[model samples]
Structures are given as structure tokens and as C-alpha cells.
Target: MDFVFLEDSEWKSLGEFISTKWRNKKLVILCDENTETYCLPRLLAENPDMLSGTEIISVPPGESSKSLALVEQLTLALNDLRIDRNAGLICLGGGVITDLGGFLASVYKRGIPFINVPTSLLAMIDASVGGKTGVNAGILKNQIGTFNHPEGVFVYPAFLETLPILEKKSAYGEILKHALISSVENWNHLKDIGELDEIGPKEIITSMQVKAEVVQQDFKEGGVRKILNFGHTVGHAIESWSIATSRPLLHGEAVAWGMVVEAELSKSVGLPLEQFVEIEATVRNLFEPIVLKTSDLNDLISLMGADKKNTNEQLGFVLLKNIGNPVFDQFIDSEKVLSSLKKVFEL
Candidate 1:
């Protein structure tokens, strides 16, 4: 609920910011191997005292680490470490770290305070702020999770400097999705930006504001919030499938491709052809399209059926009517969904 954005590479400001509230409390640092190496050093350097009484738990990086088994391992580790109800958790990484850590904090001791220090662009813009935390169940993305708001969210844009190129590109999918569902002005602004790699704090803050406003209005995701999932329903399926098959597409990579497929679906289901073509072109230009084998299409469809958003044995999706406009809870038939997939994959 509380958000702070940092401009520099050093995390001293963030360390000082949270120190007063958490200095005496038991602290747990939930991070991935990537962040532990690339991002954690700055925090420790800026505030040596910050990690004094803290316990650091590092998981392997990437979506594969977000699993029930890891959760069980983390839970047991937390118990063994004797982190109690009054403990505070600091989630210091990307989407996987924030999602798994937030979920752990929610379930541990029936809930404890946790602050998100989002080091990845995707987390800063989407995952870390949403209060939705969970891991994949088998091949289904976010099939198990809870709605638990963080005590605070610290955003340090300097972390972007160390981010891998692919990861930054992946984050653009969410940024594009945000623009599409936000306002025509937002979409236009992003469209005029020329290059995704050139996106700066201004653009990131604009996307965050759009997301924050929607989250403030629909925290529980019962209505308006569902629009934020415009690309995720299909995106998650492709992500989970990639993870299961060892293809390992980044979350935003799958999302970029999903937006393309879903745009095609929207057209098949009556979205204006002109709008769909423009949407498809924009998304395709922003991200490299993921190629799904013909044989894997059925499995992707099955994965989608297992999405948490689905209801009453139907596939529920958030689709676009146009840029900056989303229609949620639309049910599309399997055949139509297949058609869309084939359209995107060229199968």
C-alpha cells in the first residue's frame, strides 16, 4: 500500500527508510540467487546494521523456483529459524521472489508484516504492488495464492541498470499491457516512445500509477481489477507450459505472445478488425513472438482451463475492445481458442 521510488543505485535510503520500523523486529530476507548477488550487496553496503539480525534465504532464480515444494521448504526453514508472528519479511527480487515471499509471509504464523523491495521492472510495475502472491501448481500458473498486501513497497529504479537485456524486454510486456488497459493517452504515450529499452522512470511511474489506481479501486479483483489481467490468462498458460517443458520463456515473453493470441481471439469474437490488427502489430513489434509447436497447443489449452480465473468449467479471459479498453470475464469456446493459438504460432 505504501510505495517509495528510489533514483540511485545505492539502497542506503531504503535501508534507512525501513530501519526505524523494523530495526528491532526479526527480519527475513527472501531473495533469489540473482538478487542475492546483484542487488543485495548494495543494501548491505548502505546499511550494514540492516542484515545484522536478519536471516537470508535464497532460492534458485526464475519461475521454476516458484513451486509448492519450495514453499514447503521455505516454511520449514522459517520454522526452524524460529521466525515468529512479529517478524518482518523483506522480499528482495523480481516477480518470483515477491510472489513466493508474500505468500510465505501470508501463511507463516497466520500472517506477518512484509515489505517488498522490488528489484525487477515487472515486480515494480505489476507483481509487487498487486497483493496477489502464489506459486505455480504443477503446470498451472498462480493456481495457489492469497491476497495479502505488503506493509510497504520500495522501488529502486537503479536496479534496472543490472537487469539482463531479456528480462528488461520481458518487463515491457506488462508495460504494454498496462498502457493498453489504461487510457488512450497512456497507450499513445507508450507508442510514441520509439524504443522500449529507452523507457525511463517517467514511463515506469506512469504505468505504476495506472496499476495503483486500478488496485485501489478493486483490491479483491472481483470486477475492475480483472481488466489488469488482459494478457495473463493466456500468458500464464504459455509460461507454465514453457517451464514444464524446460523451454523457460520469461514471464513477459509469454505474456507478449499471449497478447498477440488473445488479440486474435478478440477479433474472432467480434472485436473490431482494425483495432485487433493494430493491437497485434503493436504487441508483435514490442516483443519477439513465442513459437508453440502444433503438438503443444492442446496442452497449452488444457493449462488455460486450469487458470484460477476460470469459473463454472469455462475459460474466462480479459480481452480488449480497443487499446486502453478491456472487457473481462468473457468465455470463449475451445475451438476458437485453438484458432487463436494457431493464428499466433502459425500452426
Candidate 2:
């Protein structure tokens, strides 16, 4: 219920961040060295007083940082600063910062308030909004986590200007989900904003709205939220499989392939083949179609079996009846999931 986006160019004002608002008692800004250097200074300069006398902390970057080691480090940092009960955490950066920092805030003093300023597209449209925050306990992507809705969220498209092209592409994969699963209008809208510079705040926020509303209805992901995981089942597995090998796929890339495979799976379930074709074309046109060998597919499938959504000892999947409508919690025929991979890899 505390979710809202900031408007006006002054949305990035750091000093004003804590003032002229319904913010908590005190704010503790969390960022990594990368965002701290590139984003914080400019933000602080504009809203000088908001962060005055506030402690800003930085952690290491990359997926590895979403580990217990990093969480321990952050806990010590908070203890040192005496950031106690009542102070809220403001996470700035991509998913890692928000996930790890938000987790830290959750465990710090047994729970406190937190806010999100997602700088990357993945975080802005998905991670930052869901309130699923945590660090990887081992090989799991989000093995140890808690669902703690941030006090507030602010997304700036300008933050993406410094994002690497790969990272930008990663975020786009999620945006594609917004369209394919819920609104074909969003799918059509994506044609105009393929490039990062071309992406506007309004469009990004709109994309987020689709997801936000879904989660608002099913915050625990008990029902409607499952639609949001349309491609994620296979995607997360592929991502983990890819990471375990010499090559690691960024989250977006894996999901891109997952969507392709699921689109085919959709067809096998009676969704017209044209829907499949459009899905394949749209994803390949946007992302480099991943070509996994027999071994990679085997490993990926093995990983998928471990998915939490599995029921009746069978794979449970969500596929589209058509664009703009998603059917969830259905048991997809195993052969369909496999055969579709053949078509996907043929590309």
C-alpha cells in the first residue's frame, strides 16, 4: 500500500528524499561501490540536506555479493553505525543492492523499514517491486530470503544511462514478460523502445504498473502472481545451469530463452502456432537466440525439476492462452516442454 512512483525532475533530489514526505524517522542509504560513485554524488548534490549527517554504505558489486559474506559485512556496518530500530534502508542500484540491502534491513535489529531506488531495469520493473529480498545461501539464486515490501520505491530511467548494454538487455527480458503475459498493447509498445536511450521513465513505470497491480492482488504469489512467473521456471533453471558451467547467462538472457521455449509449450497446449511464431520472432529479434547443446539442455532440465512449483511429481507451468491473458498452475505435458526445446535450439 505504500507503493508509489515519484514524479517531477526533482524526484532524484537526495536531501528532499527524507523531507516533505511521509518517510520514517531516519534514512540509511545503501549502495555498492559502483552506484555510490556514479549515482549517489549527483543525487546528494541536488538534495543536499536530505542526506545531511546520514550514513551511506557501500558493498561490493556483482552476483557473488549476494552472499552470506556480504550480508555479514552489512550487518557489522549497521551495528557500527548504530542504525537501529526506526531507521529505514534506502537501497540504490540494481537487483543485487536492493536484494541484499533489503535483506540486511529485514534482519537488522529483527526488522526495520526499507525503501527502493532501483537503478537497473530488472530491479525497477520486477525485483524492487516484489519486496522479495535476500542473499544467495549457496548456488541458489534467492535461496534465503524474506518478502518485505519496501517503504517506498523510486525509479529513474536516467539511472539506466550508465548501465552496460548487457545489463540493459537483461532488464528488457522482464519488460517483455509484462507484454506477453498480460497486455499485447505492451508488447506492441515495446517495438518503439528497443534501445536503452530510447526507454522513457513513463514507459518503464507503466510496465511496472502491470506487475505492481498483479502483486498487489496476490502478494504472496499464491494465485494471480503466478502469472508473473510465466517464463521464470525454466528461466531460473537455465540461468543456474548456465552459471554452473563455463558460461553464465545473465538473468534476462536466460528468461529470453525460457519465453521462447514456453511460447512453444503454449502452442503444444492448443494456443495457435501463430502465437508461438510471434513469440519466437519477438524474442529472437530482441535477444540473441540462445543455442544450447544437448548437454546444456539436459543439465537445465535437471535443474528445473528442482523448482518449487513442481506438483504431482510433474512440471507445473504457466502459458498464455493468447497475448494479454495468462493461464497458471497447469501441468504442462513433459513431452511438450521437451519438443519445444528442439525448435528453440534449431534457431
Candidate 3:
């Protein structure tokens, strides 16, 4: 429940904070190649003694690294490092780092304390704050993860300036999804921002708060939390299928496409046509259109069938009634799903 929003230069403070809070604790830094190169030096310099009694482990960059095999590798490495139950994990990178690091911490020694130092905008707003941690199970996104909250979360906005443009845009997808599901005010606020790259710490804080409020209410995703899955149902499906069969889409990019598809579904299900179009247009403005062939739709539909959100073999969704309002666990007919896909792809 602890989320700290800090300036990019403030990341150096984290070393001191960890030293003071977790005195005598073994420190294991879980980073990706990207963070090791770009972020680790700053962290090490700020806390000159930070590397002492610390084991730095680097996972390969990208979603491909989120696998059971890598988890085993990390687990075995931690064991070899002789980190006991008093050890702490510091996830230092983007969503992939937080997800893999957090999950590893949760399972090692039946659960240990972990901290998140999020570098990417996407991780700052979503993955870093939430305790949900896991690697992808096969083609499915986060099919195996635990709801293990971190001891703390530290977000450094400066790291975002180093991100590639597409990475920032991918992060924007989650922020845009937050506005769509939370409030008309949030949606309108973002519409005024124009470009996604223009989003700053203030905007990041706003998006993080939206998720924080939701996670506080439904930590285990029993009821109200399901609304957070608004775009993820189809989003994860497209992400999983694409990674397994074709070029992989970034998590946020796939989610953006999911919102587009679900927006169409919302319109067909009797949401006010005007509101649906407004939501669609706003999302489209932030992200470019994604092209999915008819064949892709078939694979996507099959992928959706295996989504964790499905119950009793019925594919469910969190669709919008209007901006700031969402309806969860709604089932749509397969024909309607196909029709929506065709509409989205203009097939």
C-alpha cells in the first residue's frame, strides 16, 4: 500500500531508505539488461555501499524473459547466493522486472519482502504498484501469478525520459484505460493532454492513484477489482497470441487494441452510441490503429477462451456502460465477438 512518487534524480534516496529500513538484510537486486546499463549506476553511486552484501541478477529484456525457466534460474541463483528469509528483493526495471522479481520473491522461502523501483512509465503506473506478480504461462499473459504486495514502491520519473517513444506510448495505454474506467473527469483531463509522451509525473501520479484506490478496495480482485480488467481480457489474448505466433506487441499496445475492440462491444451492447464513439476516438487519438487480419481474429478468439477471467467456460468481459462507468463479468456470444472483431478490423 506504500507508493512513493519521486523525481528521477531522487532514486538515489532509495539506497539509504532500504539501508535504514532493512538493516542487516541481504539485498538482491533484480534487474533487466536495460536497467543494469541505464539505471544501476545511478543507484550504486547514490548508495556507494549499495553493492556490498548485494547480489545483482539480470534477466534478459522483454516479455520473453517472463518464463518459468527463467524463474527457476533465478530461484536457483538465490539459493546459491545463500539469501535467507531476512533477504529482500529490489525489482529495478520495467513491468517485466517487477513482475518477475516480485513473483520470485513471493515464492522464494515461502515469501520475502520486496521493493519496486520502477523505471518505465508503464511499470510506474501499473505493475509496480500492484502486488500481482508472475511470469507468462506459455502464450497467455500473466496466467500464473500471485497477489503478493511489495514492501514498498518507489517511482522515479526521470527514468522515463530515457524510454523509447513506443515504450512511453505503450505505458500510455494503461493510463488511458484508467481514465476510461474510473471517471469522466479523468478521461477529459487526459484528452486535454494531447500526446501521450507529454504525460509527466503529475499525470503518472493521477493514474497510479486510480489504480491504488481500486487495489485497496479489492486486493484479491473478488468484486470491484474486476473492473480493472476492462481492456485486459482481449488485450492479454491478443498479446499472448501475437507473442506465440507473430511479432509481439508491447503490453500497453495490445491493451490499447483491446480497448478499441471492447469499445465496439460496448456500443453493440446498448451503451449510448455517442459515449462509445467518444471513448473510441479518445483512445484512438492516443494510440495508432492496430491491424489484425481475419486469421488473427480466429486465433485471438481462441486465446480469449482460455483467459483467467472466464468462468464456467463462458468468456466474460469488463465492458463500459459509459465513460467512468463499467460493467463486469458480462458474457458475449461468440458470433457477437466475431462481429465486433470484424468491425474493429473493418474486415
Q: lDDT for every model?
A: 0.82, 0.78, 0.83
* Best of the two (1, 2) by TM-score: 2
* Residue 121 displacement in candidate 1 (angstroms): 1.7
- The list of candidate 3 runs beyond 4 A from truth reads 12-16, 49-53, 240-247, 268-270, 293-299, 306-314
Name the runs in model 1 displaced over 4 angstroms.
4-13, 237-248, 267-274, 290-303, 306-315, 338-347
Q: Give the clash count for model 1.
A: 1
Instruction: For candidate 1, give the lDDT of residue 144.
Output: 95
Q: What is the C-alpha lDDT profile of model 1 across 146-225, one tens digit per residue?
A: 99888788878888889988888888988988988887788778777748777888888788888888999999988999
Task: Please list the Cα RMSD from the true structure of every candidate, rounded to 1 decimal place.
Answer: 3.9, 3.0, 3.4
lDDT head-to-head 1 vs 3, winner: 3
Q: Compare candidates 2 and 3 on lDDT and give the better one.
A: 3
Error of 3 at 291 (Å): 3.0
Candidate 1 vs candidate 2: the lDDT winner is 1
Candidate 2: tens digits of C-alpha lDDT, residues 1-347: 34657443666443354674535567788998889988888667766766777789888888899998878888888888888887878899989999998898888889988888888878888889877888897866789989888878877667777878888888888888887887778877775556645667776787788888898898888898999888887898788877666668888888988988887787755777777787778777787656678656556665778332342245778888888878898776455565677778872
Q: Considering TM-score, which of the candidate structures 1 and 3 is the better prediction for this target? A: 3
